[model samples]
Target: MNDTYSNGKDVIRITDVKLTTVQTRRRTGAISSHIVLQLSTDAGITGVGEISDLDCYRMYMPDPAAVKMGIEKVALGQNAFEIAALHERLLAYMPSYFRYANTYPPFTPASQIAAGVEMAFYDIVGKAFGTPVYNLLGGRQRDRFEITYPVFQAKKESDTERYLGYMDALVAEGVTRFRYYVGVNFEQDENFLIAFRDRFGDKVQLKALDFQGHHHWKDVLRIYDRFRQYGFELLESPSWREDYEGMAELRKRVDVDISEHISSLAQAMRMIRAGAVDVFNITIQSGGIYQAKKLFDLAEAAGLKSLISTTQEMSIGTAANAHLGAVVPQLHYAGDPVGPLLYVDDVVTEKLRYDGTQLIVPQGPGLGFEIDEDKLAALQAGLVEWDRPAHGANYVSD
Candidate 1:
């Protein structure tokens, strides 16, 4: 509707834009790389944006290179306020090589470009309104969010002691809720849950487990039976994606509530229509703010809870998630907005902070945070060469 930032002009020229990668180390032994976008106008006002790469399925997709070339090719001399137009143009012009193995798959490399452009557009809108994205979404519902700590693969039984020690320190630091992985290592899962129960003894009210689609339906049911004794709040991805029939059946079997990792709003609607999940894990990078709001509205109508989860994304997506989680009407569960806390360092001007169990939405203009231009330039200068990988680590192709 109102393009106030455009000064009543039909078009705002996109003067310059750049993309850089920031690598953050995670305790899970995986390094996360964020592709940051900087968009500037002729009037000197600028916006920041980011997108998450599809690591599990489409890890070979070189999203940063596509994002860089896509912005350079389509964003120049265009109106930043014309978000829809820019998004569509980028979608049309994006190289077909970036698409996944199957053309019909919902998640693809093009989706990343579309998400990045949408976020950049949101940044433009936020800067124009002089309000944070959260305020624009629907005002703040909660000042903070409960953090969900991720526990990946554990080596030995003794490793559970180290993990408990780590959680103990975090609990002292004001984190009350925690989520542990329940895949591949059932012993670790049992040990961690037992340790949590023994040490905390129900002091931690919120405890959950995530299977990440690494277990069978029967195994999930068995795990749920065991987890019920410990009073788990929820279980995420207990079954595989596209197993709605199986999920609905498990919903009947499991004593604990189930959450789905339906990344896009389309899948969310499908899950709701199928009555498969009790909680919806809304990821902003997978679906833009508009679509995310639509998904939240649908979830509300379907009487399902909402939890803002992370995709190991950067500050741009994290800021957007915080705003969405703060403003949404049906955010019943605490969000997994712990990317900043999990990372060793971030490449943003203002870092997202945890207040007790919650993360406050930034009150600054635009996405409520600013970009570090110096750090961005330095990161761009550090890029030696970029190429798209194929298949596995051994396969290399442009």
Candidate 2:
């Protein structure tokens, strides 16, 4: 055993919790913002966690300010290891909306807050025990895993060449797995698909064509039918999240796999019952690593595959995803924890290791990440003008 645990100083107590807001520019011309959580313990360990800003396109309202206020109310002075108890209290404090299909809200703000809290506690415990966060979850299932590189949808038809060139550069760099974003305009999507097929052929694995629940079932079917020959692996969230029956019908009409975002057990049950989803795109942003592991088990029992979804988090959040990936066996598909590579820069002192297209599971204690204080300070300064209110007007008026 390690000296930290053997000396009976193992009872790490949470003394303080701090939140630092930071934003980094993504390659897609969008800013990836996060509220970084720092849990200072009596044992002289500071556990790090990340809460991604999700106020995009006005689709969902995420309350990071509430997370800031509630973290102290729920987590201060608690034993760092009592994560389960803390989680229950946090859920009770920030209750989910239960009005829709007996399912948790598709994007529960509390879950985002809770995810950050859970991450910090796990980091504390892992450090106290002198082990990687993955060991706490179960044990390492794989040393490394592939991350599906996403090519965000072009802004307009004229930008198609630039997008294709981006793919070409990645392909040349030995990236074999990919996911393409669509749903801007069907014409651009179709033309891009045609160009992609003509250029790359079947040389690269098109892991998914993500619609992000942006299209109707019929429209999705038309795209699927036309691009069936292109051989993308799955159709991701073809319709709006609550339309289980429509998703089921679309699943029946297509031969490819269907994936949907799942937050709670009730939502997964609803999808499974309706045969709406073949793969669960489980994001830790919903409920953190422990809850994600449970979802993976549920998916496995239902004989469904799963992939870890991403909100394009920075190094800290990406490291959390890597630890989760290390333990979950049902995460057979190439996940989207590509944020470490997608951002122009990261705040970590040591970035997570990558081998060609694969991300190496971080081996250091406590989520295997250390924040660069200087970079974080600089990032926080720049985030002054990048508030959530500015993002509220990002959508079309139509």
| TM-score for each predicted model, relative to the true structure | 0.84, 0.91
Misplaced by over 4 Å in model 1 are 1-11, 27-30, 53-59, 90-108, 374-398
lDDT of each: 0.66, 0.76
What lDDT tens digits, residue by residue, belong to model 2 across residues 264-342? Answer: 8788888889989889988787777877777889999999989988776777788888888888876667888888777
Candidate 2 local Cα displacement, residue 362, angstroms = 0.4
lDDT by residue (366-387, candidate 1, tens digit) is 7877877775555442211244
lDDT of model 1 at position 109 = 55
In model 1, state the lDDT of residue 365: 74
Candidate 2 lDDT score at position 360: 92
lDDT of 2 at 157: 75
Q: In order, what is each prediction's RMSD in angstroms?
A: 4.9, 3.1
Q: What's the count of clashing pairs in each model shown?
A: 4, 0
Query: Which segments of candidate 2 are over 4 A away from where they belong?
Result: 5-10, 53-66, 97-106, 381-398
